[model samples]
Target: MTDTAHALGASRTLWELIDRRATLTPDRPVLIQDDRRLTFGELRDGCERVAAGLYGMGVRPGTVVAWQLPTRIETVLLTGALARIGAVQSPVIPFYRDREVGFAVRESKAEFLAVPGEWRGFDHTAMAGRLGARGVFEAYDTLPADDPSVLPPPPAEGTSVRWIYWTSGTTSDPKGVLHTDRSLIAGGSCLAHALRLTPEDVGSIAFPFAHIGGADYLVMLLLYGFPAVLFEKFALPDALETYRKHGVTTAGGSTAFYSMFLAEQRRRPGEPVVPTLRLLAGGGAAKPPELYHAVVREMGVQLTHGYGMTEVPMITMGSPDDTAENLATTEGRPPEGMEIRIVDGEVRLRGEAVCQGYLDPDQTAAVFDTDGFLITGDLGHLTPSGHLVLTGRLKDVIIRKGENISAKEIEDLLHEHPGVGDVAVIGLPDADRGERVCAVIEQPPAAPPLTLAAVTAYLRGTGLATHKLPEQLERVEALPRNETLRKVLKYKLRERFGAGAGADGG
Candidate 1:
């Protein structure tokens, strides 16, 4: 842990951290939107007032409040107010429709549902009502108002479960991942220490604030005393100006973000995409080693990827000062307290940063092993230097002719192909072979179409085994991705291509 993190040990809750930071750096900016800024002092005062207003509305400690708002300054304040009052907050992603929203609200048993009225041409208030949400109200430009004197004492403990974050639920209903102030603080501390950031560094939150990463990033800022630019809607060329305008020193959301920046830099060969950008760091999906080399070679910026999930916001993170090979090939190292146990090639975690469990008792019981380690479901191994190299998920293994083949091994090799903009390898059921390898690709615009023979040739040239070569190839304009983090939904691919057992491809 960094000295700052150790010194702030007295801050047991998120509200306490906010108060301490505000006291230490009252005038330092913590949040920045288009034309608005909120300093630490302003954040504390504003949130307290909002908390008082919520208190007036009978939102006391432990009250369940569900909010689905955009990434705006007000949303931050609302979340902070909930923290101040010790409310159990269930943050739903803004893009979720009735099915997801209804599931979250009902599962969390939220007493109040906060919406943005009609945002992005959708009536969230109406949807909340349709779901029979209690205390449905709009919290866009305005929030509740009352004097701060009515507010009770802030939360004193940090270990109590106070957050419920939903997963992407690609194949089934989203599961609510339970979290506490301490777990979030631990996750943030790992990120902050690994990145070696300072107060002088400016960051950017291009993803949704409702995502688990939002809290992870916010905790870093609170610890290091820095500010981040908020993007209501993040697009490549459009958001570039804001990044340049703010002199964003650190920016990245995931592997896709690195690809976008690299693409933008390619547009202007001689110029940097963001002159102030020095490092790109994020974690949610897998990172191709080629992508790391490409970002560093072309963008002239250090790219440090990490391993994390909704259950544990941060598990391992690459350090800025680590060896180049480690940064490129491994997911850095875990913090001092995080225990990584490799059981039968699967990575399991036991640490303070890890989430308490799922909202469903059955899920909680099933996910944790007897040793109290959360079964991560990811397959990986720890290097000699303690870095993690993920192979793939257990479910991602393809069984072919009594042999197990790793899909990620093929996907990583395919990522190097110039014709393949992005690719996903899956095993289609085959009566004789058990399963046949299939590759779904998204070709780059204006690039020559990719052929199955050409792909097989490239793999063969890479010295890949002939049996692992894709037997079929499917091309699409774009792959289906989850809303948050933009992770490709491979299950959808299986659904789309699993039926044809024996199909010829070019």
Candidate 2:
């Protein structure tokens, strides 16, 4: 327990916050998915009935409930209902393969698994069975209309587990991130503050609800009594239509999503800008400088970048008032009451929203210090204005002829190439230079396979030192990414390309 959690105290748990908001704005629209609309009162009613039903099903306080629900109102209700009953909610991304799904179920010691029957061409029951969890409940079947009045009381703060988020582990193996009741509240409140979300803003999110962005966005909108619009999946045309149809004023997604939306905008000219869409927000990695500028010019909306991991939630974010340069280059200032510092090229943070630690003790010990700072593996320097600019991950640094090079810097440079869709840079162990830069790229169908000479020449044209240019370029159909669409496991690419393999295959 930390004193900061006490200072930023709330009277009740997050469920109570939702209940209080419902009381204040009972008739206000709360959730909209496709054609279905739910008011605060109705949302509360559904949550109550679901919570009561879960209680009847032998779910008790402190039980871990794993849900593979899609981006639907049922998932929203289940989250709130679990919070009400003091049960820990672990959301399994719908795209998880057998190994990933099984690991999550075993890692969380989930007693009950809730999943949709069929979603996005995947069968949840079949996937859940492989995970060794018993008694899988279908999403829609769980909502019984009997309206059982008994519901377990909210779990005690600090003692109750809110949710366990598993990182993509670009730098290391996956670790279960544990958050407390205090952390979730502080995180959501900070996000609502930094993003300038209001009761009038219709919060729209296209990312999978399993990720931190979608989960926190849903909670923040409900906590602030704002209308939330949930998208089943990412479709630029459908997203634009929904934004216009729902009068959605605020949206959250990733840098890639913003880029895709901008590309769609280029295809359709003179399209009416969703006048109500005032804020376009992205988090995780910073957007490319060129992509950010083009989005602002093409979409007529401000792009604000937030910075946070699964552990700390939304710790920093670019505000609507931030300068274009700030929004483009940095991760913005740390959220209110969050402290960040740079030491030995690593970013460290301490705040109420920071989690207790990873589930494994070894992982916890590796990431935290005795002084209570979370050592983020990212390499960055904090500006004098209190903003944090991410340079690259420390592990991703490549050494060429005794000069340290950032892979992310090279990736950003490669992104400017019209033919390149996505790319990842990795360090191949070299006896001479210690490590050499190798790039794996996904190129456009119209573009011929990239040659090593072409990549080096491109780097040289940009004034990169000759030694820093990649010695090899490999083309691949698709880069391996996690459920959140973040590229990790570059070792797979290394196995294929680091051995001087040709671009003909993988």
Candidate 3:
């Protein structure tokens, strides 16, 4: 472990780590957005003042305060202030609406709710009122401000649960995952150590700050005393200016991010996309090996992908020194202390980085096995070199003719097709076959239109089994993705085409 990781691992709370880093590098930049920059010292002082302001509003220790704000410096300050006050914070993604927001507010029993008011032409404050959210207030440009002397000392215990992160409710309502200061620190340390980042390295956070990754990334900055550029609204070309202006050395959100960067690099063939960019790293969705190769070969940057989820933010992360083949094929190796047990082909996790459990006791009880490992629904086996190779989700298996096939296996193969910009393989109900394989593709603008027969023939030439070949093909302009991390909403694909409505194959 790096010295920074060792010191941060010993921290009792997130606030403690922040304060320590601030003392070490009081003038070093910690957060940057366009022309604005917040140094480590400034962050600590700002958070204290915000904590005092919140305290004056009756936000004492253990208060359930929820905020649905964008990725901004003020949002980070507010979150830090909550940590200082020992408030149980529940951060909701800014894009979430009535169903998700209402459920989170009610489930967390939030005493106070913060919104960004009329951000992006939507009246979040009005919506919070409609949901009957208690203590609704705006926290966009301005936050509570007061004397820091009035606030109590920061929480000393890191084991107590103080964070409630909601999972992406694709199949059902989002589950409230419980996290503590120590757990989040552990997750961040794993990422920081595995990436082998130094204090001189500058980072970027393009994803939602409300996401669990926000905390995970922040913890790394605190540990290494490095700065990261924050993008309130992230899109290619427009956001590229900020990355270049800040000379971001390492940046990536997910496989979609890699694709977007690669697309931009293709537009300007000879020149580098972000000249300062030396590494691209992220993990949330399955990364196609072809994407990795394209980023390395075409974009001229080392791409290190990892495996993580709401349950455990950093399970495995690829290092820069790793072999190109292992880095592309595997999700990297688990760090020390993380126990990976393959139970019946399912990945089970037990470690300090793992979450305490869900807010729902019964749900938590059902997910953990008798041995106390969180029963991850993912299916994978560890490589001989200790790397974790994820096949697909247990629920993502497509059973056709009494044989199980991995959707990721087909999707990865399809991603190699030059005509395919993006692809998702789903199972649709069929009368004759229990389930038929459907490959929904998003073709590149320059590529010629594809047909069902053409896609199957390509797969067959690649040695894919006849039964595993996609029996149906549906072309779309773009695949449906969630706001954060841009993971393809496979459930949405299944819902749209499950009834054989869009099948174009024999």
Candidate 4:
């Protein structure tokens, strides 16, 4: 496939494109909230005013602005404002508690912070107070009740940093990913092409605008002159309602979230059917084939899988016309300007999409091999047709008696079990062998207890390889996941199980 000509322009920067949209489509709906909406003109004015405010506060081209607001109009303005002023916006998911937020603020060395006054049962003021007291951030509340009007600031452009994001370190510490004006525009353009977004398309965003997925989708919508319905928080039902009410043509999310939402929606049927919805797109984690089938066959929408990270934003995305097998199994092919290769079962990506490197030079050097290919720790293989099929994490793969095991494969199979609610499989050190597969399970309140014997029996019945079957299984109240509902703290299980935990020990 050839790169789409519409995906890029010769000289237009991201800020310039946004300015053109605001100027050309001033009266058109740019953002829609429940009972309120902002036309392109209003959004532009808001961004300008916010940029002016930041400038008064001494925000400059290279400054890092950490934004921790819930989904709202402010998130839009803050993001756009930062882009216009050449300031780097580091979006932190609002759901992150103290430790996570503290880590982001400290690591990013944010000069300024923006958050809500109160949102979704969280006290924003207190959170802001804590961040402010930490001595690195200057926090501001985004409630419309206070400081409603502000001045429009002068444009800041050319040679300015636009955004900074953090990669989700499923197997290691989070690494900082930076984007300049050119790169961000490139990313948005790639996303627009991958999703085939158009001027008439409308998107409702449920994910927090702080992450790359959220920001990429938001910017793509704007760049294409499409309207975006912003959510202050994730409410599955509310999101569905928005889909129906707005006749949302597209939406973006993670595999886990889209699975949960699609599962819930399939259980009940009615009007507000959202027949207009063409694509339900997501990435970062592998989605079960059943979930993808349900979203397509049952719900009558395309469940497109994409592949990207904070380091390389939206590099590949499946098309609506993709085969069901492709949609369910692979992460599609590379987007414009991206080059991908698989060496020794590990995926390597390079191009404008690649990150500038981690905040720490040593860490950055460690992650990227020579020749500039990002040594994505993800274990994947290129299909005969060039599609990328993710197997599991390189560090997360379990080596049991010389047999390599994919934790994701086992976890996916476990999710099909009737009694299992959620699970995380990890590799723990073993004296007899290099490592052993251990599963930490979270069952529903009414579900019966799970045992190692039962798990092995289930795996056997499912026809999984004996080597891939978990040697140890433990039922826990819950597994530690991130705010995105992604399993992150699997190390805790290995810690508790101890290095030498055996099959019988569990």
Candidate 5:
């Protein structure tokens, strides 16, 4: 399977990968959604027809098309059509509003924009009109279609930047991440190799399809010739029925997703969440070592977490054959083509999967070093055996009285407590201490209320250092998370509590 996937991965463009896969197993199913099953051959035909329609609508080879759509077969088909047209495509998360959508389209100089007419009662067409976006059109259940002969030739080269993904706008407006078809194919190839998936295996895309991971997952389907269930709007238990219905073999999106499944499993002890589920794997957020163990023990499945970002979707991924200890403690090893170098505790990466650069050339210049390695602001070290263990982000280091404290270290310890459903440790501004450790927690149902003193006592009992104790704690109803991956927006916590916003403790 690896050899075949590698060969298919060599295809110059995404369209080429699709064409190759279609030729190999034209009758095999590739995408399944509520009542709709699309085979590989049908996918090719649909993409070409959609491409013809888009071409008739003035979409040329280099035309910039920005789309904001949900996870649906039509969405994937539209993306394929754009690829077939050799258009520079920029996808926006469906949840993004006026500011983000407007910024992305304007910044990308989008020649056309696609949106669902009125999905989930939002009236996206109206929103696009309000933004004064150009070439606005609806592409939901019914897409514009035409004969394939009307379209031009598909893109031949894969190195040109044809895909623009957005960074999580946790801080401000997201920078448009530039990716070539080859880069995406490389990332997906790393994933397909590491997971050891076969044609018999089924996957699921529970997250937003507009995310960069969407392409990575799509490339895997193309390479391995497998089908994945698409969730337009995924919710627990409700979506579990589809997982079971499709007999999904591999499932996971991020750490938040794993926690959701674990919480659901706890509802029915000794029962599998998804009976067919064998492995849970994902990246995009920090996975606590405790979460890894819980999923393994209670759910009766192997959990393989990886390290990836928008810049490089699959830098390192945990293989199913890795030792339990490595799976729990490390982020797994980089593949043959990936090069990892740690300088001053920062993880630097140089690999085919890495994106070309950001839309802002200045930002790109700042991120890459003289050696061309993308300077990941993440702080970590590689083990002797080549396993990468991330400590925390460079911005996550909270210094108090000349001593540096890792927020991830404290959060990991706090996650072990039964009373804590979720927690985020932030460094709040403190005049006396320069920066003070503050822990914000979300309480679970039926759990005892946690106080700052009780939390500090628990940390001490865990053999945690005295100075690393959180000086302040805030119990919130829920942690603020980005819509895409549910990654905790720590900056929001700092903004909320740093100004002495009535938090508990010193």
Candidate 6:
């Protein structure tokens, strides 16, 4: 972090950080969308007005406010305004339907809700009404505004929990992860310093603003005094124009995002997808080594992957200065304040960047160790150079006839095939073996269909063990992915193929 950023990092709360940045870089652009550009001064002044508007609506300090809005300029203002008033925010992914949204709202005890009205033909207000949500209001194009005189002073401390971010909850109802302003600042600072960004660097937020990475990215911009283009509805080729127009120096949401850009580049061979884009960086899901090599070779951009989650938005990030071998094979080193521990081959973390805990006290107690380290159920070990190499999650282990198999180990090998665009290896229940291995594939359109024999043959050629070989194969038009980060939903695949979605091939 720069000297100015380090000084800004000492702010006691998110609102204080915003105010400090606004004071220093008042006229500098902070957010850009279509034709709308918000400067730091405008952001500070605008949010204070909105803060008064929210206070006028009976929102007080510590009031739980739930918002399900897309990635837009208005969403940031609402989040900032809430911070200015010291409200506890519960941001739900916009793609979530009634079930997950209702669960988050009730669990957070949200006293109010902010929606986008009828965004994308879905009436969020009506859904909130159906869910019996209180204090529902629309905040799309226009926001409530009032004089700043009506609002209370901004938050005085950063240690108190003020954010409630949800897990993806692809398998079960999501868990509400608790975070404070200081924790978020640390995560964002880790990202900003690791990437070595400057004020001249234009970034892009192509993912949903409801996710924890949203806050992390926002903090990066605030710290480095840079601007980022917002994509409310991001898609390939269509969104490429905006990226080029803004001269985005850095772009990416996750490994899925890198694949999307690569696919686009292949569509128009010998042409740059986004000429100004030089670095593709993100971390939410595991990045395949083949995917990294392909992206660096095809897109002609540096790809820096990382290891992060809702609990700790920025654990370790690959730096642009690191070697290509390290960038391709391992998640980069953690910063000074962040600590990574490998306990019995499982990665455990204890740091300020880590979340305070979960909403439920029992869940919190179960996740943290006796020494205050957050027990990440992921299996991995630190490299000699201090990089993180994740093997798989504890739940991702496939036990067949009392023998343990790592799904990631098999997935990594299969990802090397020329025909395989993406693959998800899952374990399914079987009458014979305790659990059978299944490989679900997403292939290119022009590529020939891969048979189970061909896949097993390829795996065998790679020297995969017989016990770890896949027993079944399923082909899909595309892999099921969540809205944010585009992480492949392995549980959904297990649910689909576990019910005999495809014939067994052994």
> Candidate 4, 199: how far from true, in Å?
1.6
lDDT of each prediction vs. the true structure? 0.86, 0.73, 0.87, 0.69, 0.87, 0.87
The alpha-carbon RMSD values of the candidates against the true structure, listed in the order shown, are 11.3, 10.9, 11.1, 10.8, 11.1, 11.1
Expressed as tens digits, the lDDT of each residue in 1-506 for candidate 6 is: 79998888777889999999999999999999999999999999999999999999999999999999999999999999999999999998886667668989999999999999998877889989999999999998888899999887788999999999986322234678999999999999999989999999999999889988999999999998999999999888899999999999999887668878888999988788999888999887667677888888988889998888888999999999999889999999998889898999999999999999999898899889999999888899898999889876765566553234667777888989988999998877663343678999989889999999899999877645565679899989999999999999988887887865386455
For candidate 5, write residues 1-506 as lDDT tens digits: 47778899899999999999999999999999998999999999999999999999999988999999999999999999999999999998886667668888999999899999898867889989988999999998888899999876788899999999876322335578999999999999888889988999899998889888899899999999999999998888889999999999999887767877888999999988899999898886666678889999999988998988888989999999999999988999998899999999999999999999999999899889999999988899999999999987755566453234567778888999999999998877664454678999999987888989999999878656566788988999999999999999988998888787354768
Model 4 residue pairs with clashes: 71-232
Write model 4 residue lDDT over 350-454, tens digit each, in one string: 887577777777878887888889997888888887778887676565644323356776787899998899998887765334366788888999988877888
- For residues 1-506, could you state the per-residue lDDT of candidate 1 as single tens digits? 45775676447999999899899899999999998999999999999999998888889899999999999989999999999999999998887777668989999999999999998887889888888999888888899978999888899899999999987322235678999999998998889989999899999998889888889988898999999999999888999999999889999877667877888998998799999999999876566678888889999999999988878889999998999899988988998899999999999999999999999999899889999999977899999999999876755666453234668778888999999999988877653344678999999899998778889999878656565789888988999999999988988998998888334462
Candidate order (lDDT): 3, 5, 6, 1, 2, 4
Judging by lDDT, tell me the better candidate of 2 and 6: 6
Per-residue error at 372 for model 5, in Å? 0.6
Candidate 4, TM-score vs. the true structure?
0.74
Q: Write one digit per residue (lDDT tens) for candidate 2, span 76-160.
A: 8888788878888788766655555677788888899888877667677876776678657898435543364676456556445
Pitting candidate 4 against candidate 6, the one with the higher lDDT is 6
Residue 20 CA displacement from its true place in model 2, Å: 1.2
lDDT of 3 by residue, 1-506 (tens): 66765876789999999889888899999999879999999999999999999999999999999999999999999999999999999998887777668989999999999999999877999989889999988999899999998988799899999999987322335679999999999999899989988889999999889988899999999988899999999888888888888899999877667878888999999899899999999887667787789889999999998988888999999999999999999999999989999988999999999999999999899889999999888899999999999986756666553234567777877999999999998877664344678999999998998999899989877655566788889999999999999999988998888766465765
**Root-mean-square deviation of candidate 5:** 11.1
